[model samples]
Structure formats: structure tokens, C-alpha cells
Target: MRRIYHRFPQQIDLDFELARPFRDVLSCIARLHNTHTTSKGSGGLVKERMIIQVADGRTQFLDLDDLIPLSEKTSEAVDFRVDFQRTLLTPEKRLPVAENVFYLRIVDKGPVTECYAAKESPHGDMDAMDLRTFLKGACE
Candidate 1:
């Protein structure tokens, strides 16, 4: 499981962070798209969303309801939302090496097997991100 932190109150300032595999996954999404800014600021998207699978192997999209505070959740389970604009920060190309950023997408069924898809189809065909590669090189 991956842990992501996000700001509360949609009207508040935008911010968030991802850990391990999830962070890696998001980084790939960002790199392919060349994403760098959002309504919140230059940082990646701030919304929270997660990829889920049903017993039948069908994929489900779950959004973290801002009305409910995440701290209220018990040990049973947890829920979150996804904000592509905030999650995928723009990479600094000025450095000797480019930094891995973040990206947003809607996978068909499995988050792992799916290829990098653009945030929006009408926007055009952008590079698809491979979560595995992001996980390997994200950390300096």
C-alpha cells in the first residue's frame, strides 16, 4: 500500500506527497506529460484518488470525499482523492539531471499493467509513464 498526504478543504492551499511505489507511479505520469503546474501553484495536483479492483478483477475509481476528514477513518480501511494537476510537479530541467515529477491518468483495470495515458484524451497523445521505472530512479 502507498501513503499520500493532501491538504484539506478544497478552498485551502494545494499540497500533497506520495511514498514509495505510489510516488514512483505518479512520477512516471508526470515525466511523460511534462506536467509542472496547477491551480494551487507550480507544485503538482492536490486532489486525492485511488485505483481499486473488485473481486471480479474489474477496476474501480474511488475519490476521497472532501466532506469527510481522513483522520476519522479507523483501522478497518482508508480512502483518499486524486488531483493530477497538483501531484505531478514540473521537473527542473536546469539541473545536470532531470528530476522525476508526477502525472495523472485513468487506468482501465489494473494500475500496474496499464501504460502511460494522457490526463485528457482531447489534449493529445503524450508519453506514457511506467511506474516501475519511476520507482527505480525517483530517489537521488
Candidate 2:
């Protein structure tokens, strides 16, 4: 099993600990496209897409070619949305149809320190003291 802790600039940090390996996540994404194609019983072009949402709110879309390289052990982040699409043969013509969508957020905790030490006080003001003071007391 592995654990992942993703920290945001202002938002709360997310902690994810799962039994599945990192490669399994990528495989699952690939399976989405496979299942859709098999179930549809179509030989049309199936596209496996991924949309990565950065902390700054920027989005980057990727195809299977782009995602294959990212399935390495060195990948520290897996925060993205996945979509499965295929060409559909309607009564009139062929059209692109979205089969499914999925969201994932898993960051490796390999670089996180065992203990975090705070030197300066946190900026937030609570009652009278800052957030650091409040946390220090609460942790103790």
C-alpha cells in the first residue's frame, strides 16, 4: 500500500492512502476506453482523454499518447479528469459521443517529511492568536 498527500497553496491538503499501485490507476483509465469500445460493438475510433486541472485552475487536455509516458513510478501527481469518447453512428450520420467521465487526485507522499516544523506564525488571525499558536496548542 502507498499513501499520498497533496498540498494546495490555500486550499486544504488532501490525504489519499490506497492499496492499489500507481500503475493500476493508469490502467483503470485505459480500461474505460476499452470497455466503452467493447460494449458499443463498434470499430469506430475510440479516444481516451484526460483533463488535468492544476491548482491555479488551468486545464490541459491529453490523449492516450500523452498519458502513456506519465504512467511512470516517478510520477508524483495524478490529479486529473478522464473522459471516454467514441464515434457513434446515428440514423443520419456519425457523431462523436462521450461515453464516460472520471476524476482522479492522487499524489505520492515519497517526499513528505516525517515531522513538519513551523518557524514563523501562520498568517490567519483567530480570536486573538494566529493559526500557528492555535495549532501548536491543539496538537499538544
Candidate 3:
């Protein structure tokens, strides 16, 4: 007898640096927050999370609902990262295709002696960046 397997969700990920701060790296979450992702949901970023390394060598995190104020001055930050994720349908013609996981990432780090803002923007200039996407789903 022959056995068959059913549909299974596929995990996919694409990682690359924008090479630009996203307007350039500031090595701090505050500068990142003030940049493009300033918006949420329909206005801007669909989803996001941040991890920052402070002067004491500790880590701090922020979510979409909790934003760090620019006036707080995180200029001394040594490292930072941004994770954005959403779900979309895979392009496979196979049956039972549904929205799956997709992610966008940006990360930067340097010696504690360097300044973060002085670095180049990798993926943060919102208006200057570009992405190629295809329309897929049962409807299209």
C-alpha cells in the first residue's frame, strides 16, 4: 500500500543588510525608533521588536506598544537589532496553501568605544529602500 503525506506549513527566512544606518546605524534603539518604524499597523511597520545593549553590558527590549523617547539619549548603546515579521501565502501551486511566516531583519554592533550614529544606514531610510514582492493567495 502507498502512503501519502498531507499539507505542512513551511518556514522561510531571508536575511540581508540594507548597508545604507538604515539611514545608517546609530548603535542604539532610540535612533532606530525615531527613524522609519515610527508608525505602526496601517500607518507604517506591520510588526516589530527591538533589542539594545546598554553601557553596562545589559540588554533592553521594546515592543510596538512601548516606544523609547528620543530625548532619553541612548547614544552610548553598543549594539542593536530589529526584527519584523508577518504572514503571507507561499507561491506553491500545491493544495492548502495559507499565509506563512516572513521576516525582515537589521542588526549592527561595534566596539563600545565607537559612536553608533556615525555609521552608514543599512536598511533604515524607509523612503530610499526597496523590496520585490509577488501577489499570491487563493484569491489572486
lDDT of each: 0.28, 0.37, 0.27
lDDT for predicted candidate 2 compared with the true structure = 0.37
**Model 1 lDDT at residue 48:** 23
lDDT of 3 by residue, 52-94 (tens): 3222223333332343342233432222323322322234432
Q: Candidate 2: list runs displaced more than 4 Å.
A: 1-18, 31-35, 38-59, 86-88, 95-100, 109-140
What TM-score would every model get versus the actual structure?
Answer: 0.20, 0.37, 0.25
Q: Decide which is better by lDDT, 1 or 3.
A: 1
Question: In what order do the candidates fall by TM-score, top score first?
Answer: 2, 3, 1
Between prediction 2 and prediction 3, which has the larger lDDT? Answer: 2
Model 2: how far residue 13 lies from native, Å: 16
